[model samples]
Target: MNGTGRIQVARKVVGVGSVGTRAWVLLMDTLNGVEPLFLQAKEAQPSVLAEYCGRSQYANQGERVVTGQHLMQAQSDIFLGWTRARGDDGVDRDSYLRQLRDWKFSAPIEQMIPEGMTFYARMCGWTLARAHARSGDRVALAAYLGGSNAFDEAIADFAETYADQNERDYAAFQAAVDDGTAQATTEI
Candidate 1:
């Protein structure tokens, strides 16, 4: 699929209920039904198999926890114009994240995740990368580390889980194929 198509799918996945739901969809696509297994591991054997994972890594590295306050500040700064124009109520992180994720999937490319309070965490890495590449600023390294690339990498890692899920789906379908009782397929 094209980038836009992938983005649409991501948006749809994100819009479902909570962050856990979005993660589940991605996991289902990547790992089959092993989400339960992972969840179990997270609870039972968390330090072993589940270590170095997305949220875990972020928390362990202290990046997310430490920079979280700054991220909020940055987001507020970026969205100052929007807030002024809209006269919207103060931003809450959870609500902002949901709206931002939705906006990312729905907005035109140019308007996608503009630099601001809601997007500060997402943009920090890219901004840092740009600054470092241009001026060799060490401070930018910290920002780059906190940027969207980190989130992108985390999401991409889940593709393995999705692949596992796809394999399971295929296996189930293949069993039907072997049984000679498979339902007739219909095109969309």
Candidate 2:
């Protein structure tokens, strides 16, 4: 995995000022061990973004790995497929939240974080929505996040319910396992 490379395709449609610059830098650092293929939209100071993305340093052994994302989604899909084949487990909610925390400080401009913050909230909401759809538990996910709002209402509801049920399920399972009433192939 260390030798693997990541191709990052990002758009500056929202804006390329300090926020965009910071995002580019963080993406580069986060993927340090791997080869980086970067593609910046032409609308966002194309020349400057290209220069930064393609910069070569002596420390990198003169390897210029960054490239444009002309192919965009196709390239992204291929790279994702390759990563999946390499046994990289997809990011889960916990890991996603951690990444958000890291991005907050690493971002180029702190004030440009409102949108980014919303992204995390939306993710949480989506996860909770899915869980609710599956378990038919209206308040399960919402309780986890505390309150109901456009950002993470669904998750908060689902989490609240899930916690209640999960507690009961876990207690029963643990008692059964301890008493040898439940057969198991391994200990959790």
Question: Which candidate's TM-score is highest?
Answer: 2
For residue 126, model 2's alpha carbon misses the true position, in angstroms, by 8.7
- The sequence of per-residue lDDT tens digits that candidate 2 reaches over residues 1-188 is 25454444343333445354212211333345554333222212224544667744322211111122212212222321100111124521110001212222233445657888777667756654564455445466455555547555664688799999999998999899889999666667
lDDT of 1 by residue, 1-188 (tens): 23222212122333333334222111112223332211100001112334555334442222332234344332422321111111135522211121232232333445556455447545656665454354445566566667557757776589778989999998999898878868646585
TM-score of 1: 0.22
- lDDT per model vs. reference: 0.38, 0.40
Best by lDDT: 2
lDDT of 2: 0.40
